[model samples]
Target: MIYLAIGFPPAAKSCAYRMRETANNFVALGWDVTVLTIAEESWEREYGLDHTLSDAVDPRVRIVELPLAREDLATDIREFTEERALNPTRWSKQERERHLEHFPELVFGGWRSALEQGLLDIHREFPADLLLASCAPYVNLAAAWKLWEEHQVPYAIDFRDGWSVDVIGGGEAFTRDSEAGRWEEKVLAEAVAVWCVNDPIADFYRERYPRLAERVHVVRNGFDSDSVPAAHGAPNAEDGLTFGYLGSVNFKPEFLATVLDGWRAARERDPLLARSRFEIRGHIGAGASREANAHMALIRQAESDGVVFGGPVAKAEVAATYGRWDALVLMLVGGRFVTSGKVYEFMASGLPVVSAHEVDHDASAVLTGHPLWTGACGLDAAGLADSFVEAARMAVEATAEQRAEARAHANRFDRGLLMAPAARQLADTVRPALLTGSTQG
Candidate 1:
């Protein structure tokens, strides 16, 4: 199997966990998986690479690193052209237009040719029976299509977030007549199976392409069992509780300010929170900004309210991080279309959760049955403050049994459990076609 997974292992992006699990699961199912991703150094300008993440990958699974890198994210002053150094925004805009000539994506379109040639070379050497493409570079679709056009290799897409649906903006990203939309339509039309992270996204694809509706499936990003704490320590009322928010700080600065305002309000009203601490852990910005972005400024400004930014945590230390925290603050963006992987990890931590996102979010749907969740409060300061106070109360008062039940609620969402079945099903579907020497499309 050829796994076109750009953010595979070592890349410290949030999507790496899902990609790693997918490739490992395929290897476990007795398939020789070759993951195609960029070199380790290529990730440095993006999120910076984490070798610890690579340690978890199955040794049997082969990885093929392409020599591709994102030019717009280049941080080295010496590497910059004079025009780019003088007016970065205009240069980036012109570069984006150039990239669109190669493919529809803005940041990753230039990688299309390298990816296509890479797949063709890999296939020439090994003769792959199947190709599984993961997106966000959505350029992987071009490569998968290239292989399918030339060699009859069946391909499936792990569309973590759907293409046409603007998850963040809450609308179609482009019209069907647009180049990007046309590319999405053409590539997805022939996909043997299309996996989406949530039902809303699957519905969008289904509604958009009714003839291919049955091919769409929902494969939620479940929490890794190893990432969840085995046991939760009793809340230390004497020293005050530790509230942690672990995940990418991808939300806007204004959104973060609202969460801080709520935290401050909660601290003022609740005596327990007065001495409590809020820790933010995860990658902040890419390239030159890194941790020196507006988000960092807002978090630093909230220091008086007991908020501290802890930077990024290693994958191996995730469980330990969860164990140390008394409760979780789930600060997310978007509405019903978004269901972040953090939601699963937070629920699995068995900690009381205070949601700082839209009331109509898909994460709200997942947290519906969770016992310790304070519920979504629509990103409003007063409402989120109430949620924080309630979560603090739950953290201090909830019994160990309640925490156990919370973990049990999330057990069904174990990464292996959620992903293995889908992986096996796709493998099974392709096995017969290979045995009979038949083409999928």
Candidate 2:
């Protein structure tokens, strides 16, 4: 089966790793997998590349690159229109409306013809038995639907975050009459299966389309074992304790400011934390903002507070960096349904975790039983300040047994174990149909 996945390996997005692992697992099960995705240059402009991630991809799987790009994520100043450069927010809003008019997809609507043609070409060379379409842009469903309409090949949809539900804002993303909602309904109506990352999202799909409830699967994102270092490794003994925050810096400046303020407050109260260092590693902005954004400025302000923004780290350095960290600060942006991929990795690191997200995020569901988790109350400066101090206390006082239990909680989410059954389910769903057709023949 050829996977119609657009966020395949080396895209640097969190979904890329999951896509790669899924593809590799399929290959291991003796299936030829072809990953359809945008070009590496497209990813570079959006989130940059980490070729080291490609090392884990089964060499047997083929990757087909689409000549598509997310203009919003573009970094090249030469390519930016003067109007867009002057007022990017307004320009992007207009661009999205224009896209909806044509194809009902915003970031990916324009890829309709490109994706259609790409699918056609792939089918012509090697007919696909099934098409597994993953989405965020939601345009992938269009391509997968096109294949189903044209070739009758069974397809599945992986909605990491539910399309119609606003996980962050907690409301309907769009009405049923709207273009995006209409498109979602139409495409999902024909899909054989749907996959959501968390239970809330899966429940959304079930409530939205009751008949398709059985098809929606919850496939949790798990940390890659190789991305975690041994507990025996020593941290920085001479300089100071390192508290790490790693993930894309896509949250609001006010939110980041609150976290920084909290860090400052914690430093003022706790002697150990006052002398410690905070290192944040991740992408900030692309295009014109680059390093000239308010987020960068805020991070710079915290430099005097022993806070250092270290930019993006390569995939190879993920484990080693975690090993050197004394504790972790999980700064996230969403409530209830939002369970980030980073939470699993952070939990697996066996370090004290301080949450900087909404009080009711889905991540809280995973970390609730964890002894070292400080817990998410809110992102208020003062509240977060208290939370940080509590986390520091936990870091210093947490027992070895507690750390071991934290790792044990994460052990249930090993990617291979979680995905193996899901993959087996996919195979099981497809096999009976193949056999029935054979018998009829």
Tell how far residue 325 is off in model 2, in angstroms: 0.6
Residue range 209-253, candidate 1, lDDT tens digits? 998899999999989888988777577798999999999888899
Pick by TM-score: which candidate is best?
A: 1
TM of each candidate vs. truth: 0.98, 0.94
Model 1 spans with C-alpha error above 4 angstroms: none
* Candidate 2 structure quality by residue, lDDT tens digits, 120-160: 78987888777888887688878887887778888888888
| TM-score of predicted structure 1 | 0.98
In model 2, which regions exceed 4 Å deviation?
72-94, 232-239, 438-441
- What are the lDDT scores of the predictions, listed in order? 0.91, 0.84
Q: After superposition, how far is residue 261 of candidate 2 from its true place, in Å?
A: 0.8
Judge candidate 2 against the unseen true structure and give its global Cα lDDT, from 0 to 1: 0.84
